[model samples]
Target chain A: MQAGGLPDTNQVSTDPLRNEVPVTALGEASVETPTRAQALLRKIEPYLYLLPALLLVGGLLLYSVAHTLAISFTDWDLITPPRFVGLQNYIDAVRDPTFTRSFTNTLVWTGGSLLLPVGGGLLLAVVLERIPGQRVLKTLIYLPAILSTTVVAAIWSYVYTNNGVLNETLRWAGLDALARPWLVFAPTNTLAMIVASSWRALGPSMVLFLVGLQTIPPELIEAAKIDGAGERILFWRIKLPLLRPITAVVVIMSVIGSFMTFDLVWVMTQGGPGRSSETLAVTMYRQAFIMWRMGYAGAVAVILSAIVIVFSISYLRATLKRSAL
Target chain B: MKRYSNAFWPLLVALLLVPALLMGGSIAAQDDPVVIDWANDAAWHEAGQDAVGEASLGVTGIGVNTVIFTSTDTYQAAVRGALPTDDAFPLFDWWFGYRMKDLVDAGLLADVTDIWQGHIDKGEYPASMMGSFGFDGRAYGLPKMINYWVVFYNKHVFAENGLEVPTTWDELMAVAEALKSNGVTPFGLDVVGCRWCSFIWFEEMMVRVDPALYQSVMSGETAYNDPQVVAIMEQWRDLLDAGYFSQPGDFSDNWEAPFVNGDFGMYLIGDWWTGSLERAGFVAGEDYGVFVMPGITEAGNRSLIIEGRPLLIAANSPQLDVALEFADYFMSVEAQTVWAETSDINSPNLLAPEETRPGHLVDLANAVANGEYELYTRYWEATPPQIVEQVVDLLGQFVLDPAALQTVLDGAEQIAQDYWASAGGE
Candidate 1:
């Protein structure tokens, strides 16, 4: 069998208890060949073990996706029965100013995710590798990641309010001009939410990178050092290249996560100040739940899913090709 | 691919079918008591469920099961999602007017015209109230509770400032000026937490300025940026510029301590707010007093903005007769009184006893009943919900920054135009 795949159960085991067919029982009973029904049952036993998970994934996950796709081609408000409208909902989405704004904001959020969470996380991981009291520093830096997203959003909202701690501190330091309500304005509102999201995401990203750094062979670094490689050169030429697999995982997660961000934005600004801070997910939620435009929301969901799927496929293909070397 | 054993497909299907069959259990047996599931969003009234259930059960053979949702948004979503299926609640609370009209138009709500007419004939409910819950000459709901929009003020602060409740447009402005001069914020504006609160002043002032214009705007006959509406916006701007309003506060059902502690001299809100104040330990008529807002024009005098929710019966409910019987009982004065007392809110029934309610609410109810004031639906319920939701956000922005008045007004007009045009009303 391939590495990490299921074990080769056809092989005999030295331990009798561990063997699927007991050697003693076979010898003592002078076992005859199994009947067709018994052999068939034996062949299907492994599949029986997999049935529950298959059903759950098929019944709920696949059904929901298919249902959403079907609904996207219709016009439906919760109050009225759905009417097939071809590509009308998607057409409406394309023409909508709010949808355009949300799409742009979503791109901005993704960029922010790349810069703050992924970049900062790597920087933190590298710094921790050379720092004293590394364990304490690592724990402290990773603390916020363990919090629930809603709690993080709520805490950050309090910090961003007009009279909240951030503004109060600014006022105390005579930076009164900077003390505007951080969550009530457009780009600033979106940025503030991104910062909150990054704070929560940073810990996990840092931890992953730390694990990646540790997995690097110390002997390779020693050889590079012996060949006169300095700290920066060692990291650039050797350590960074070795961390590609973990980096791929982190980047993929951050990309999909930034695309699907909703709860933080919803809790903090509700995409408000007149839909100024809305991302695509926020727009989808508002359309479906608040406006009761289920079909339009389904279209938004489908578009979002298509984008994420495309990104995932292209990213995995590139990363896997590079990693295979 | 190698074909699976013959038994595999059937086994998989049966395993999947087991859960589906369990979830879609057989309908209740004939001997079971008809349980009427009543979905509501009023978390505060959860304690009163047993009393309400007992009262309704005595009148109808059905038992009541009140399911209280966390918030209005969730409740609305849940009710709409469940209405088409057998899992639908037999009854639920919903907003009146345009909000209710959506459900009525979809043929989801049971017709209650006969029950309404019966109550109207008995003089238990006013005939005029029927229009709010009716469409195409058919009533689809019964009023669960009603609240009149009134200005509640701190009596001690008013007395300290030597001001009485103003009765005219000029007098009200003068009172506000006096309160401001005395170093008290003239109004308590709650817009942050309770999103719907942002529409209160807009609705209140619009009706006060010109009730006809307000009605026209709501009906899509007049643009929100019409010159008349601009004039009202200017008046509101002047108040903001004069610093007559306090910083916006979060106004949940439990957050009445700010107003009770004299943070603002007056608060213009629905009479239902009295419950919050009372819960915060403010005694009605002694600690505070209520007054109907005076008109900006002569047309505004004695005009009150009213808001309420109605209890609707699902058309496809299995216990249709029992649900109807309970609804009929709900319309009776005794049932209304019990519900009002238990919930601590005003009942829609005109003949319900008022002794149990606060003195201020009782007086307002009397004034409304005696035709001392003309009633206009609250803006939230008066206009299409889709427009209202977007417009309220604009209104909130305007509240935070009065300089955005023109932008806010334009945005509102656009939203209104879009909704009206799409609905084929314009």
Candidate 2:
């Protein structure tokens, strides 16, 4: 290894665990073997630097996850000592109609997020790329994304309420039939929340797409134009194909975001008109906190996490393997 | 580099040591006036603190620091998550009856039986009040406030419509019809303001239908979808069909605003909301008057729904002696009077002077006494919280679309059945 403590690639590949004698970067100092204590110190130094983060992960994140997992197998009201109920809670969760509704709503949210934010963002980015004063326009569009989730939820709740701006506008436009209590019912409530979510999400998705778009070589677009290709053809052929990598990242993020949707739905609909608009995240919180069924809620959280993890892992693995090739 | 490293150690050590020293200093000074942590979610927490200050004069060396939580859900989550631990507040507000059962069973609540015995012996509180806070033959909490559910009407609106407070089911329907025809939403069924608001009408309707059946259904002796319950839902639906309720979307976090603005002519809620109405600039006798909603049947007419909230002591309180002193002092007439007058709510301590109570409460108390009404627990605390939450959600849907009565009832029944089956019934 180099004396500056930058290990050589060959040295690392050959004997990763072995202590190496280092020559100075200028190759002036003689190589000296590390003593046993020095070798142990070298091994322990990296972990020592990592100790705070390790403690944090183990103490907070991993401990809570492990505790939740343990509680999932029991029947615990907040007040009572947990009674082990085996897989009853899981069975109950699966058989429960509310869980089924929440699961279905989560899927709808995921699909809506992909289409609304990702698809709409790409269109927006492409359009902004051609427009003058794009920077200011982009900032304005992204403003909602910078607001807190609670604020966004509050704003949307006002717009979507029964006698709210949307309904009033509809009535003014002589389109009373089109107006309804946007956050008070089933499909519409979920759809309204998705639109609100999409509005907040569009900014980041657009920025990411813009970054992707700019990375494409100018020569490529010039060549496409020289080949008698129009704007639509260029976007469909070269631009869309090259944008796949960023799209995959955005898609994964949107899917995960949709799965963990609690704040907006909670603040707006509260997963209600009777849990009709609940996502898995809202259901988990309501069960644990509002209903005080810790064990049942644990089962729900585990199910939600398992779904997200499995989807993320499989998608990421596929994307990484393809990207590597 | 060596000089920097030499200085960094002491700097980091100093940073860590300062906080440790401060914490130790605070711990050592615990012998000073003890500040017991009191957690609550009510808007009247300042009034509660005032009452605490008054009570502290009697229970020497102990003052309370009241912590406010913004919502019921957040408050319950915070309190329940910290229970059976020293980290929990030594004093916290909680609902009475079934809501207190789980906490009591877990032994997370201090046994306040002795405190109750003292209050009862002094005739400060009635023995009947103890039943709601008792489990396993021991009282676990002291009454914080008692509120009766009654309809509060705008006296001007009633007079303007040439109507009087309805005394029969038919009269109530006619009043509703008259109000609706006059283009005023006759009722405040603002299910959107809070999830629990959905249960207010469900509870009102249940007892109005039959008090015995209300008890049977709440205790899980009868199915939630039973025909009688369905009949109650049908009656509620008829009200909806008549367009007596303002749309749920018409409500917001400022739940009292629309009622205060005269958008709705009447609101049926706990008498505790009297303070909120007053805060909204409604005079007690001039702007509003309270009346029991006439029942649909003879049994329903005889019953009144009441909500009792309690102040619980943590069993693991570090200052158990101070907590006990606070609890005992809070039950005294002096404390109750200060609490009632300041908070504008009724005190369960019967010995509290009637003049100290709010005029609305006094009038309602007189009417209830004269009518010989049988008081029952409010629906929110009458059943297990799990069932209440699930059923309330279903009821919220029913409010949105009254045509889905059968579907809502079925869903409620399923939830109640699952809970009862698992709990092995009450």
Candidate 3:
């Protein structure tokens, strides 16, 4: 039977009961109307429970990604009606000086962010595992992680100021000529901000490394030690291989975080002294929000997302392949 | 498992309705008490809020909900993203000038012409000032006050060095020379952390070369490499070359001691900077004084760049009526009085008593109406924001390396072509 342009979903099959299996003593029909409804419900119950969550998650995530992609091809200034301009925004970004500079700075930021945090954290974790005062030293290193980004930015700004402690120490050590303004120029300013970002990020990276290292069986290390494996030998041969999974996670996170740098750069420099220290994220922000060029900003964001996805997918595939072997 | 799964669907449906009910209630609530949302950038946040609070007190039972963002960029982002939607504030603090035209063109701003016209008919607001906020006979904003860029000089430094406030370009240069030779920095331009702060000198020089030419450049009609613009940059470079400005800038905090202690003799900036001096315990007239910055050639028009925070009404706001009411109140002399008292600045409303003004602002206003001074909006706001972002960066580059003036101008000219061409197409 039809119901509002669709079939009645609860309709029962028009089959004779003669072919149904018979119960001798109870004499109750096995395929009754109530059981048919119950069977349908049983079949769809799991999906019914999952539908709400799936709709919410898939709806937001897919909608946002789709919208960003669509907006990348349009000329929208947030206030104005969006006009589809195809690949013009991306083509413009390719030649735009600020975009190019930000793209290059993003690469540098990512490279520095990856190496400093991941490497330093790994090395520190290794050293701490063998050291006597592990707990106290761990707390000291982890303390910075708990401090807010604003607090970190303020602390570093003071440390990097021309008359800050760094310069004062340089003067006291008869190196007054060597002291200079850290956040006042290009490349140097970018490097200074990167140092501050890494300082704030290193604590978490070390903690992740420590957690990963703790999961490794001490018995295996002892066994290696008994087999004449020295300190360096053990780290390279066993601990390093064992820590690969966590390292993969750490590297991806650090690289992504670096590409997404805004708060540190904003608080420290605000992408200034001539837009020299701007990263991809900061450029996107300036374009979309400050400049009121939302479409071009979307293009920048899409490029940033593509770059991030490329690195992440490449790393993930390599890790998965290694695991497969 | 059945019991837990059975409860989930109803819960999910209920959750969706909660937001719907709340959203529905919000739209309805806008009709009563005329509760309007106001988003303010930090510069105007404190004074604007105080003025509204005090003014709303005068009008019985009006709720002005304000959210203040410390960073200008953050608040600008909010307006760009949240405007033309129910979520956006009915009223927001904005900059006066070309920004309004763009917002109006995009249909994001309400044409508050009636409110402005009502004030005009009553002889409360000036007709000359209203022209900047108007486009195609429809006005988009209210001219709140004027903050003319002026020379703020330390009185004691001037007295010690036998210097008086210069009346012309030549005299100003001679004063700079005298002060610099005496080991005192002529200008208190410590803007290391904020490279954009250096653009005021560019702003000053642009208006100085020729106010009309500056306006043309701001409107994207003239290129940055225009002979007049080049001359302006060259003059700015000359000032930088003379070592007139103090070294190693203080990053824009008023608490910096150099300007107050008389190490720096003068600062060529907006008159509002006197408030910063006041906050730092410097008396307005005795410790520091202000003067109209002279152009190379006046031609009987001493043009001054006026910069200030503007209050704007969102067209799509649920509380549009009340926002307009607040705008009407905000432009009144009563509100302007409270604003100046709380903000310590000048009000554009003619009805505002002169005694309610800052000492230097009052002097500047007298010069504006009766003397040769012509008040114009700051070029930074006068130009398109997108273009301003690009050209200002070049201006900063010119400051970093004065020799790169030619390069900076060339780059700026290219950026001008791109944005202006796009704007024309639109």
Tens digits of per-residue lDDT for model 1, B1-426: 113444657877998899888766644244566667788989887655556778777667667878999877788898998887766788898889888878877788899999999999988877777877877678898888788888999998899999989988788889999988888888988555445667989998899978988889999999999989999999998898989887642222224766777767898888888878777889888999998888877888867898878889998777677888888887888778788788887787888877856677777777777878778999998899999989998898898799999989999999999999899993
DockQ of 3: 0.32
Better of 1 and 3 by DockQ: 3
Per-residue accuracy of model 2 over B1-426 as CA lDDT, tens digit each: 335534755987998999999999999988767788889998676776666665785556678888889888889988987887778789889999888888887788899999999988997766766777876678998888778999989888888899999999899989999999998989987666466789889889989988899989988898888998899889889888878998877865565777777888999998877888888998889899888989999888977998888999988778677888888888888878788777766777777888987776786676554547888899988898878987888888889889889998888888889888888875
Which stretches of model 1 miss by more than 4 angstroms? A1-34, B1-30, B154-164, B178-184, B190-194, B247-263, B278-287
For model 3, the stretches where C-alpha displacement exceeds 4 angstroms are A1-56, B1-31, B43-71, B81-89, B112-123, B136-138, B154-171, B178-184, B190-192, B248-263, B274-283, B299-301, B316-326, B342-345
Give lDDT: candidate 2, residue B97: 85
Residue clash pairs of candidate 2: none
lDDT tens digits by residue: candidate 1, A94-164:
99998999999999999999999999999999999898999998888899988998889878867775567
Q: What are the per-model C-alpha RMSD values against the true structure?
A: 6.2, 5.5, 5.9
Chain B TM-score of predicted candidate 2 relative to the true chain B: 0.93
Per model, how many backbone clashes are there?
Answer: 0, 0, 1
Question: What are the DockQ scores of the candidates, in order?
Answer: 0.28, 0.35, 0.32
- TM per prediction: 0.88, 0.90, 0.87
